[model samples]
Target chain A: MREDKKTPSVRKLRVRKSHIKTRLVLFLLLTAALMLTVIFAQQICPYDPNAQDTSISLQPPSLEHLAGTDRFGRDMFSRILVGLQTSVLSTLCLVVIITVAGTAAGILCGYYGGILDSVVMRISDVCLAFPGLVFALAIASLLGGGLHNAVFALAVISWPKYARIARSQTLSVKNTDYISAARLAGGNSIQIIIRHVLPNSIGPILVTSMLDIGTMLMELAGLSFLGLGAQPPTAELGNMMSGGRSMLQTYPWVIIGPGIAIFAAVVIFNLLGDTFRDYLDPRNSRRN
Target chain B: MEPILTADNLTKIFDEKGKEKFTAVDHISFQLYPGETLGIVGESGSGKSTLAKMISRLTDITEGNLFLCGKEITRVKGKALRRAYEDIQMVFQSPAASFDPRRTLGDGIGESLRNHGVSKVNVQKEAVRLLKECGLSPEFADRYPHEVSGGQCQRAAIARALAIRPKILICDEATSALDVTVQQQIMELLGRMREEREIACIFICHNLGLVQSFCDRLLVMYEGKIVEEGTPDEVIKNPRSDYTKELIEAVL
Candidate 1:
């Protein structure tokens, strides 16, 4: 067999630097934009999200109202910004809870592969059989409508997909020679799962988690639209759109502002998730 | 010479629903003496690999007694089983898929030592020395499995198995995945190491010719049973079992 004399140090270094730089820039930009929106929400608005001015009610976009005024004379622009915070926060919470819980359950189910595996998978399958929205609504109604309740509902509904994916990946990884080698080397079941199985299975789990974040955001917005999520005066994008549907002909900015924010957030998250999927795939890197 | 390891009436049955129950290893018995290589030759599904696994305690013996160093290891579990593993290690067929891709080669080798409570500093030193001894560079310690060639990875695997200083090294088609040239090199390395360390080895393979040259004694398995067993010369030159004759004729 011929061994290559030249070390791939320079090539590897270049690939590493470029990959990290791209991810770092994208992460920083997204984080900064989200932070700036929260910090400047109060300063930029001419009126509060709940402030009512009857005289300027239903006003179109102008110098006084940047995104026009709603039927209640509340600034559409301000409400959208505040709603961004609520939507972002609730979605963030739902994503974290679902991913962590789902991935953990999936990993355990996949690694063990016996009675626990069967039971956990059956539960996940049952949860998955229900329409996500209807399931979340049923859960939210039972728990009583609020931001936390909606987040909890969405998380409960969203976790099964992650769990299933994680379980399958774990099952495949657990049988690999390394896991057997670890077992032979005196590693316990937990050690084999944690050290051998989890690390190998994490790539797919991470990709799924990233993709799930966007779905969770959309689900949260849908709940808010149905009045099962953030309450009035809380400044949620879905709630703002729902409140603006009646006077959409007179002041279109009420719907357009929140709609654009939701679109941008979803697109950015999807793009970031795609980038991660490509990066994590060894085949993709090998080709480059 | 007395046998260091022995298996009596070893059998493994697989229950496939609706289909007839399959016996992989059927009442197979073998003994491995110190400082000897017992080559188990068979076709695929002949249960040679299964028998090797049972002897190494990598898999449980379905209906048999396996004595390791004169101790009945069939019922061993937990710490006792682990102690048995320290004295008996296995090298698998696929070196590429054997080591955890996420960890460095050093970590994979060090894992065996760490589990047996070997000192941390000594593990590293031993890991490096073992890697070098197996014809791998010391720099291989920091690299992942994908970063190295298949032969190199297999060498690292052998090194990892040797890290615990196993008395009996089990090579389960260890050189099957390598190229012809690399195969000879690995076979030579294994033979030299066996002599140097006075380790008993159970070399399981389908290739009768390859093992005949390296192994002192040969065990020919057919349909989960040891059809014949004798010195390589007797098995290769004056084979009694029809299956063994067919195997040698096909290979030679």
Candidate 2:
């Protein structure tokens, strides 16, 4: 009986150490790739994304333009690199806004939990009622098309999800023994929420934010496709695809180039998010 | 002896769904004189824990009052309410569940001192001292809840409750989750603390034998009411209430 117990515990310890190592490796690789992409964006791409050559318009893949020329004679590969920057930038902005706004709103509603909670949640419900695309389009139309406006539109629609998650987490954490202990020690409401509630609830919030980044990127691309995102000459993926679609049959590589960029970006973020969810979730970590 | 804490007709009622109103604590009254241990004993649904919660002000009284150091706590609000909290601290049943697993045990204990505006240096020193008193090494302060054993976690929780040096310490099934050996040690520790600090305590538990040894006085609760109250010797040797006798027999 003693050996049986000892063996399982030893195995569990090994598994836990390996899990931590896997997480560290994945985190480092993903962050390094993202950083490098941003740092060397301009140096790596040979063609100026905005500089068009009418003479080489509609040319197929060649040494001059590796991914070939678009209908406007702009190099598709260069524009795709610039498009990576725009997509990553917009998604980063959206995540920051959602993380800050959603977490704060969630903490307030969850900790206080009364008339204020009802009021805040009802507002979240109203926002959630609208389909994501419709909400984004409406906000973009109102704010007018630009990089900042796209980010604002995405953030406005995205915050409700984080708020709902944060609020639920806060409600559960506020009742924990640590919270009561804090209160009994003469810690006021603000002190209790900040010290006890937020730390416990942040793990889930972080996992959700990681997953939200992928969805935010997709939404930004969709909005740009509809002419509601980045304007012309801005070199966004959606705009590049839109500009390439007209001659897609003659030059398939034009759409293919930007399509690959979007696919890689989304897949990488989703994988990282899934890995993070597994690592940070207490239940999952405990099981391992 | 002057009472450090007293509950006069303390009651708490919860409005259940439909027309049913559940009385969790019904007109229960008791007193904990300085340096005395009053054990509130009952089964799971008997409201012993509810009574302890009221004494600690974890739950508000519905129709009665509580006094700490001669001040009425039922109507106390704002700064007065916060000030009242410093005199009373609670140790919960499941120490692991009570604390945030993300935080270190040291931070949890130091937070209590920090909240009352104690200096950072003093809070750390006191936290270390309390941990040591609870039979924990100072190194345990830097570890998260998951890193420690259940008994050690409970000890850490007790240290956190004692950090303020409150006049009253309320244990809501504090040792029930521990093994028999650990439970005995915890009971002995409480006895030692009561002797050294001269602090009043309300020990809430369902185990009659456990309280019989630890408590000076015992109050028997039944369905949210204090059916019987007296010294442990009197209550155990010559039980007056049928429910009290049955509870004692059932546990024995």
Candidate 3:
């Protein structure tokens, strides 16, 4: 037979930029730096985060106290560093839980459809109905003040978006003939879902989850700022901001330190999410 | 001789919101003897595809019974369901959409063979052999569906259908989506495969000329019901219904 009748399908997969290698790498590097700083936060900062250092209180940025000192005589630089660690970790936990739970809910409903879909989707609708941040605030406050409570509240509020995305993505995929062919190939519902649906829907869900991590971080900071997260003495970016708000005029270093950390962390995560969304989404690609 | 496949009073009704209702396929019955190609021809929304899906157990049958090899399969479930699927396979119109984009064409072709108990190591090699049988190179099996032309993808699809060793094959407007020349090539390939196997085939399409030329018998469907059924020559020489006459006239 004429095997060379065509160039063959492999050649079409040209070694081009594809979807997200470069941008994903850049974002990943920025994220790794922040994560590493968080992982080794104590070694990165020399001062005791909670220790009273009245001797250096209100001192502007200097070689000794890089972020000066706060009103309580605690080191601002150390506090901000530790705060970032708390904020990022909490957000990571929240997004992981939300994405997992949401994607599961979406796939189940989308696969089985009918009454199960009705029940899960209605619950998703109810969750999506109210303002997500407000709902999170309510849940966090009701659960009492703590970092875990805020993460829990954030997860509860965030899962529906992922559920909606997963469900919709699954819906589109389930209609394709490959899925029917898989079914015809004697694949059970779960096999079809795990082998086919999951891989196909994961890209968008991941993109959304990455972006949501940034949002969750911001929300956690907001909750801590409002006194609903990160109890006193525990360094957290929002908590530091709250502590420095009163000393904004005299101890500008305190506010400045935490603000920059939060801003950079959120930007890196958001950029990563946007880049992934663009790269992973077939609609956004020109080659397709 | 006993028919290899039979559908009795098969029907499908779409009840939108329990108010607006439409019947996609009415009580339609047909019999396919072994090694016969039975064509169901009509315009779009003529229920030919719905019929194919119902027989292949892809779509839920709202009414009537299905008989394959003399066993009633009105409600296929559990292990029996899997057995039923192996007995029959369907090729969709959109060849590219019928194969997973993330996987190689070999994966798609080998899926049924693996399901039918072929070992993993040999499935790829077997799939390559099947690809060659379909007039494609072994390398074609390694490429994704989009990497090949429509005709090539359709060949891969047929190779996949053959992998299951099905007694009955359903082609749901399979060649309708291809270029006219590609359609002819796929038709020619399908004819060769039919000649070499004892598989009964159901060709669902809107192309009257293809049905008349390729199929042993033609069943004309209109608005969810079969308006006429006979050998192609019988229908072509002596049209029994206005719908059948009009369909032939349109082809002329």
lDDT of each: 0.85, 0.84, 0.87
Docking quality level of the chain pair in candidate 2: medium
lDDT by residue (tens digit), candidate 2, B108-210: 8887778778898888888889999999999998888878888999999888888878888999999999999999888888888888888888898888888
Q: Pick the TM-score winner.
A: 3
| Candidate 1, residue A25: how far the Cα is off, in Å | 5.1
Q: Pick the candidate with the highest lDDT.
A: 3
Alpha-carbon runs more than 4 Å astray in model 3: A1-25, A281-284
DockQ metric for all predictions: 0.59, 0.66, 0.59
Query: Candidate 2: deviation at residue B180, Å?
Result: 2.2
TM match of model 2 to true structure: 0.92
10 residues in a row with least lDDT, candidate 1 chain A: A1-10
- lDDT comparing candidate 2 with the true structure: 0.84
Over 4 Å off, model 2: A1-31, A281-288, B17-19
Tens digits of per-residue lDDT, candidate 3, A78-167, equal 888888888998888888899899999998998889999999888888888889889888998899999988888878877888888999
Backbone Cα, N, C clashes tallied per candidate: 1, 2, 1
Angstrom error of the Cα, residue A281, model 2: value is: 4.6
lDDT (0-100) at residue A171 of candidate 3?
A: 95
